[model samples]
Target chain A: MSDRSSARAARAANPDYKILVVDDEPDLERLIRQRMRRHIRSGRYGFEFAGNGIEALEKLVELPDIDIVLSDINMPKMDGLTLLQQIPEVNSDIRSVIVSAYGDMENIRTAMNRGAFDFVTKPIDFADLQVTIDRTLRHLDEWRAALASRDKLVALQNELDVATKIQQSILPDTFPHVDGCEIFGCMEAARNVGGDFFDVIRLDRGCLGLAVADVSDKGVPAALFMMSSRTLLKGAAVGVGDPALVLAEVNDLLNETNDAAMFVTVFYGVYDPSTRVLTFSNGGHNPPLVVHADGSSEELELTGGIALGAVPHFEYGQASVQLQPGDLVVFFTDGVTEAINLANEEFGLETLQALFEDGEARSAREAAEMILQAVREFAGEAPQFDDLTCMTLRVADE
Target chain B: MNVQAEHHDGVLVAKVEGRVDSSNSQDFERQLHEAFGDDAGAVVMDLGQLAYISSAGLRVVLLVAKTLGQRNVGISLCSLSGPVQSVFEISGFNRIIQIHENRTAALAAAGK
Candidate 1:
């Protein structure tokens, strides 16, 4: 059988469906209703009537389940074409058909253009009307199903937005203060959430702790791992005896369930407030730059083991530096130095070190700002591919 | 910066107000230490009037709490607004510090 016949057969197989008829002529409406009574009486379908587009809209509001709208082209107050245009806006899932006694080519084209499901000329063909109603109702069912799925997708998007907000709220909002020291830091994510994180914590007995870390990969999973690592680091710093030992314990804790194959690069340190001394350990992280008081700086050589979550038994090594007053330590993720320009030239460590040689950075904050400005200038219009994060620390004389 | 201290029954209540940045953190710290110098049984801090707080402010709170913890004296923070509460929560201060909705609840929790 044809597609229309198949649709009608499907509707006949499933009794108890509804269709709405909208037209201005009472006689025509009566005749259509009388012809439709056979299908209604047979429990195949039900029929409702509307005098114009206005009445049809009211009926739609009252009964949202009115499967399809069979309307006339010429009607008082509101027409079939107008109703078709409004259907998608108000309730796009409701299928519509345009029926008219005077069916010209222009009217048919106009009705179809206005989003009518189909156009039927009126000489009172009951068989054709049944087929049209059946096909329209089938189309309406599919449209409604698609709309339901879209609504669910929108709800999921809203939930994700809320989750992102909660994650952002957990991060440190502002930097801390140290006497006679200036500090600067920035975090830029390629997506909603990033893997890079930095923190400056105050320790007991005139001591301060500093940390910079990069979780493997990006997005939600990385963000989650970053949070867990942050919490574990805080707990270890507060409870663990030494920085290297803290990383060892954190590594074991993280490797407990190592199925995801995720890992992190970290540099954790603690600075003595009285002696201007900072002791730190690296866990396969990038070496940070240590700027001296006499306008000189050098990269702190990495002396630690592999990154966390690589192996359960790995150990990190610690290093110490006596920072004089006005000395600065600059820590960053790979994003900053690796940021590329339109010419594909990376803002490498050499360029960063060169910016420091300008001798314009009087404080740690100025140093951070200068590096950020240099990177932005170098990148020009190129979009950031990863999270750009940095932290600066200045030691003060007691 | 506004610092107000009053002794109610055996509880010492200190109300801190305004921004607590590096410039005024020392003054706030000094005032808090002085208020707690008399070996008060319990100290309740009312932060409702506090509008802005930086890491310096956080350090002051942490220091006071640690000092009180060592002395076996209880410290309770109360009436924290949304922003101040957010700062504390982000820094994990809420986890270590005892935060209450009001001074009465805070004082009661501190065994005042």
Candidate 2:
């Protein structure tokens, strides 16, 4: 119940510190009330009296928010030394200030060894008692603050782990099976959940919709933003023939309340199986590589536009290329090319361009595997900072 | 990353060297802030020696541009080539901010 202690700590007209005073002498309670009257009136301190160790334990159990215990060593039912050991059992955070007689040095040493926070001589000077209470409370404040922040960090980490699982679940794990056309996609996750994601949508008339996007930041915030983008993009792409129009709609929706200033770079394309044509639009994302069955490879041109959610009402344009039988189109996030190595050199677009340049014919799955293997080999032992996602679609023979 | 400021007639040329990624972006932002002043007529970021920049680095540049824009002070960048130039273009940052071929060109067009 540190929570109750914190709430009590914030209230007005309530004591800053609550203390339990235990002593067998019947006059001690009256003397303490008279001595501490100013503290009680100013709301700086509240004192609770207990006749012996047994009464003190009961009082502490009832009012767990009690911060300090001021106890005398010699008592009828139980002594302060025995209560000192058991005080922690009630509340380990409770600081004990032993009230022993002056020159009771042996018992004082034993109390100190037994975990008494501080001690005051028993011809009890109320002034020394106040100083001890103030010092103990100061320490408790620091301890509580540190503990609260640590607890908050632990809770945040646990939530992020859950968020990572939810992010992974939303992505397409199994590519759609198109007759005579092979499709495959893979995402190599980084240590922290990143914003990279890809989706494959099977549309009417044997058409396929594909998307690969990277949100600006990593972790839970990016994951949440990516989820919104994925849902919006999928909904907008349905029954929409124009890739640019779909992106424009999703962008406007995202910018409605995009106060976090986050943005996503997305490449959305739809391929018509009958016409063998692939139409696509880019929102500041890297252009995908296209390889014809004849072994000609080229990058789709870049569109001079910012990532989605940066500017409102910005018109995005669409572009298209005719595909032939056995042609390949590869989509990827920046994590593929920007993957750093031991020399701090990037995997770079040149390496990817070269891989796509190969004249050999490869299936969609084979090409996806080849790209991943190359990136891993290039990175060597370097740590990956972002998730790497790649998707390949190969046009089959007529 | 290293941010070295050189004062010209009416502008401050901040020559940023090395790669600015997520790791040193905060330090990069601090050094860039330290290199420029509110009274300067203009700021020119020389990315000639800059090998690379991630989105985190772009955020620092965006903040500097926005802060200077609000104060009516001029801001521009120069000497971006290859991947760096492409990144600036794709992100559409090239549209909002001015660009020059070199530091001399930026200085000549300073405060315009």
lDDT of candidate 2 over B20-80, digit per residue (tens): 8656877988999899866788899999999888766776787788788779888999998
Cα lDDT tens digits, model 2, A234-303, are 9998956588988899989998987656778899988887787888888888889888766677888876
* Model 1 Cα shift for residue A123 (angstroms): 4.3
Residue-level error in angstroms, candidate 1, position A278: 1.8
- Residue A272 of candidate 2: its Cα lDDT? 84
Model 1 residue A363 CA deviation in Å: 2.5
State residue B30's C-alpha deviation in candidate 2, in Å. 5.6
After the best TM-score superposition of candidate 2, give how far the Cα of residue A35 lies from its true spot, in angstroms. 1.7
Q: State the DockQ, from 0 to 1, for candidate 1.
A: 0.01
Cα lDDT tens digits for candidate 1, B41-110:
8889999999866544665777677678778888889999986785565334565678999987988887
Number of the top-ranking candidate, with DockQ as the measure? 2
